[model samples]
Target: MTAPGNQAVTMNSQGTAMSAGPQPAASAGSLRSALRLWRLLRVRDAGRSDPQRLTGVLAVVAFAVTTAVLLLVLGGFGAFQQRAEAGGPYSDEGFYVVLAGTASVLLLVPLITLGGAAARLSMARRDERLAALRLAGATTSQVSVMTVLDATVQALAGAFIGTAGVFALIPLVLPVTFQNRPFTYAELVPEWWVFALTVTGVALVSMLSAGASLRKVAITPLGVAARHTPNPLHWSRVVPLVLFAACFAVLVHYGLAGIVVLVAVLAGGFALLNLLGPWVMSLVGRLSARRARSVGTLIAARRIIDDPRGAWRSVGGVALCTFIAGLTAAAAMFDSVGSDDPIVADLSTGGLLTLTIAGLLAAVSTGVMQAGGIIDQRTQYRALHLAGTDLTVMHAARLRQTAIPLLAAVLIATAAALVFMLPALGFGLLSSVPLLIQFLLSVVAVCLLVLAGNLASARVVRTVLA
Candidate 1:
């Protein structure tokens, strides 16, 4: 019944169906394309055309170096704690070491915040490239994968550099004694597994952060072109502040039994501050915007109101440093009176070390955040420059943006430190001029350091303009 040609066509169709059953050729092509994409990402030219990409890489490197240093410092503290726990001449100091370790660990927040800022800044800069990729037929998953891979590469490079930094720092750290004994190089240097873990941790953090940043844009390619306005902060933000106050009250009521409790409470309080800071900043911004008497002030206030979270990220670390400085000052006064106590002397030293480390890290964080901000806003900055806006005015606005929040942070942290210290030291402790001066000088120094860091970004602005 069928024509001869029809039979030939039926046989061809059956062969075609058999050949299409497994799709081996299509799968292999996909695998090959993925490999090619990976190779392209590994190529230097992939990042060379984009200056922001280079800046992001540098930020990651800086973050890794700082993280490595922090981990080493923490390792040294752990060694001291271990020695104290062994029950010898240092047994009395074990609690102090434990407290110090906890404080050091708490410092990780600023570092993590700085890393997040960097990742966000990096993502902001890549919006155009991402959109282009999407337009060119890359699926959202492909774009997300590419971003994560980019972050992972940068993080891996940074971690390796950071490891070298750790080795270099060990010699410098070996001479510093804690608990009446210098740390052995071995004690300061973490184990091989720890180093490996650090590298892995950094890479994972970078990958997750980059991936999270893409969530806003990955679903809809057009989302990359649209800016989402952050909602106004609500009353719920006050809960953290209230919780912190309660914790402090409990500690004040318990007194000496509260030292161990105080450490945990202090950590919680700082974390709460992180939550409350942006809200407070938003409130301040609104107030300042209403009272603004100049163009610079108006611009700065509006900027803060628009992005309070970003503003806080640049100064939160300094606020913590200010608190540490205040606490150290109070501790030093106690040490002066209790000269006979070796434990008090050791605490004073540890507190000063903590202040120094915190301040240094804060300075670095401020600088990195500021620079990243400049890079992220370069287009606007350039447009403003072309519009004949005075560079000095822009500079002043930038300073004001940092200054308002920073002043508030220092005041809040210092007040809180005083309140906490008052239960331990009577009102008479406030009359210690030497300790007060020392604290004031330390706070001023840290603020100046942060200011310098922020100002350093002006160079980036200039570079961008050129």
Candidate 2:
């Protein structure tokens, strides 16, 4: 209100000052500070939009509910010991250790892989930024360390959290008083050396996982032009395909017997998802176009099918984790009925039920991510709207794309179970209350995952369309 002349003069002076100054240095410094702050913020936001966190929480809860699972594993070992003392048929300490050791190793590897995989995925998403650092004269080692630090920190945090949970639950899981017999809590505590080794292992795993993504950053073309472009994974297809073929062949040759076959199957499944997901998506995309009755439905379907490989590895890994947990639970139920030991039977059944439920919750993360990806592709849906497509039909089509792969995964898990456990526990799988509960719970889990994914996607679309 004072004077238009004064305002004009002030604006001109500021414009001239900004133009005349050495601006690049200031701009670069400001950007560097901002980027640093953003990374710190991201590190702090661990598990905020994460599926792994959800899964871990559910796993811990399962552990809490089925304290008998822990007791049973230990008790089973003790039973083996007692039988050996009495010269019973199932009295082999070496056998118990072999079984327990194998299970423990299987559990440890995937968990370690999870730490690395999460880091790699995050780094992949931020590849452009990393490439910039490389172009700015950053050494490969420096860039790798900087990019992987976030993952290392997260892995350390997870390890600490897990260790804390164990310590906290020890007393609750193993009570001091049982039938008036005083028990020492020291026995319940995890050995200090073992706990220390575990934390170290977790940290190392996280670092290694994050380190894997550095190859893309260090090797990719760098500089200003690299900004805002998709990071190229030159051999992503070939390497994964080869691994998939090799692993699958090994697994099949092994005939799905014992833990070795199980491990092979898992590795093969992961590789296959990585290799074949893109091809599946392409096929789905083509089919969707041919089946399109309405414009919106066609577009949504095509969009989902076109990117099947986009998040396939993550989804596959999540599905694999759930499958293993579910199978373990189902096996425990079988053990419950067949075992001569009453305590083993009771604990196995309880653990089986709890783990099955927990596995479902863990799977929700991947489902949510799939839904999120569809929501992000809103421009395609909007274009369909312009072409006179129905929104509801489009939404349903998107959901169908997600459901197809999950259905396949479920079938594979079921088949693995039939082949592996059926021979050991005859007729247990046919009619068992625990198995029924586990299957029902898995269904509930999948429904919940779908609902979550849909809701998340819908919310994204609404916001963008608005």
Candidate 3:
């Protein structure tokens, strides 16, 4: 009986030990998860603490807010269209509202591009920290998650602020009349779900862009340590331009069915331009490289040839603005052919406002991107400075880099606009002084704004080197 009792005691002790061992393992896992969360929070806190990183966040936020505001305005125009279709006072000219709404939607292109630029800028600033994180045993996936989290946070904050901005703008927008009628706040304000969707969309875009930008660093952790040269652009990019031309020819021969077709063509043309713009820059760079007489010009040309996409990203908004100006000018000329319809006047005003917003956003994006490039290349800049290279030469190279692509964008956009418009507006429209003045002024204003923005980044270079 004593032996049997000892055996039972031994069995119970073994069972208890096994149960206690599993509990500690479970506790260890939970602790690990908690620690990960803590580390993520710390990483985010560190980003916030750095001024350059914080600026990047702010830029993302500002872009998000701007996008949200534009979306809200689009919703308002949509609402106006619906009301007009319901036999509101401007029922005869309801299509104007629709056109305006379409223009507003198209404006999203620049906003999206601006957001992307800001995200890339942010990531560029964080490259070293990300490399450090990788060296410290953080997995690639973990670093990516952290980047997405940072972007999502900034986007969410921007969305919230943008929502508030919409509300704030309501009073200001109320006084502005379209077709001589005021817009009620209810008509201008979007539904809560729309705002929710806007926030979600912005967050998703930001996260995706941030993640995409990290692909290089994620693949080769060492890639973050140095910049890699981009691959040469192929000739295939010309396909879009050819396709657009063919489509435009067909549309013109048959005549556009309605405003819808016109809008579709315009939008499609712009999309093709987006694809072709970089390729064109590449060609320009190559040609400039061949003829480059000075070191600054050669450096600028080579830089653009190497990364035409980057160069285009900085000036793409200006190109879009140029297109808008051309279209608006042609419309103004067409409207002048007859009586100055209040609806036409209103449409012109809306177009001008859209162009202005686009130009401003372009300026901001250019400044942000330029500043980011300066930050990313600070070491190289310092080395160059130490090697007796005049900083002024570098500045000149940057200016030339910007100017060449910019000139190409403006010329292409203007030519495309005239091609599309001349078919509908007739050649007589070209002689309209008011139309010419408006168009030229729009181009000049946008150019000045872009230059100013680029100049602003020069101070950033000085600060970084200091």
Q: Write the per-residue lDDT of candidate 1 for residues 1-466, one digit (tens) a residue.
A: 3221111100122222111121222244434443445345345323433455547665675657665765676677667766777778667756767766766766776667766665565767666555544444444444555677667777788778877787777786677666677778777767677778777877777778777766655565566766566788886987867776766767577754356676777777788788888888898899989999987888889988998998888889888888788778877887887587767777777778777777877777787777777777778778889999899988888888888889878987887777667766667757889988998999999999889888877777776676
| Candidate No. with top lDDT | 3
Q: Residue-pair clashes per candidate, as listed?
A: 0, 1, 0
TM match of model 1 to true structure = 0.87
Question: How big is the positional error of residue 47 in model 2, measured in Å on the Cα after superposition?
Answer: 18
1 against 2, candidate with superior TM-score: 1
Local distance difference test, each candidate: 0.71, 0.46, 0.72
Candidate 3 local lDDT, 55-127, one digit each (tens)? 6555655655565566666666766776777785667667766676677766876787787776676676556
RMSD of each: 7.9, 10.3, 9.3
Model 1, which residues run further than 4 Å from truth? 1-50, 255-257
Shift of residue 373 alpha carbon in model 2, Å: 5.7
lDDT of 2 by residue, 1-466 (tens): 3221111110122222111211232244434533453455344334333322332232233222223223323333343344446553443434443444434333333343234333333443445444554454444444554555655555556566666665555554344232123224554454456566666765565566556656766665343234343443333565665565455445556665455655555455554544555555455556667887865546555555545555343244334444554555665675655666533543354344334333433343444454334333445557766877666766676566555555544554455445444554555666877776766575556545544544545544444344
Ranking of predictions according to TM-score: 1, 3, 2
Give all TM-scores, in the order shown.
0.87, 0.56, 0.84
TM-score, model 2 to reference: 0.56
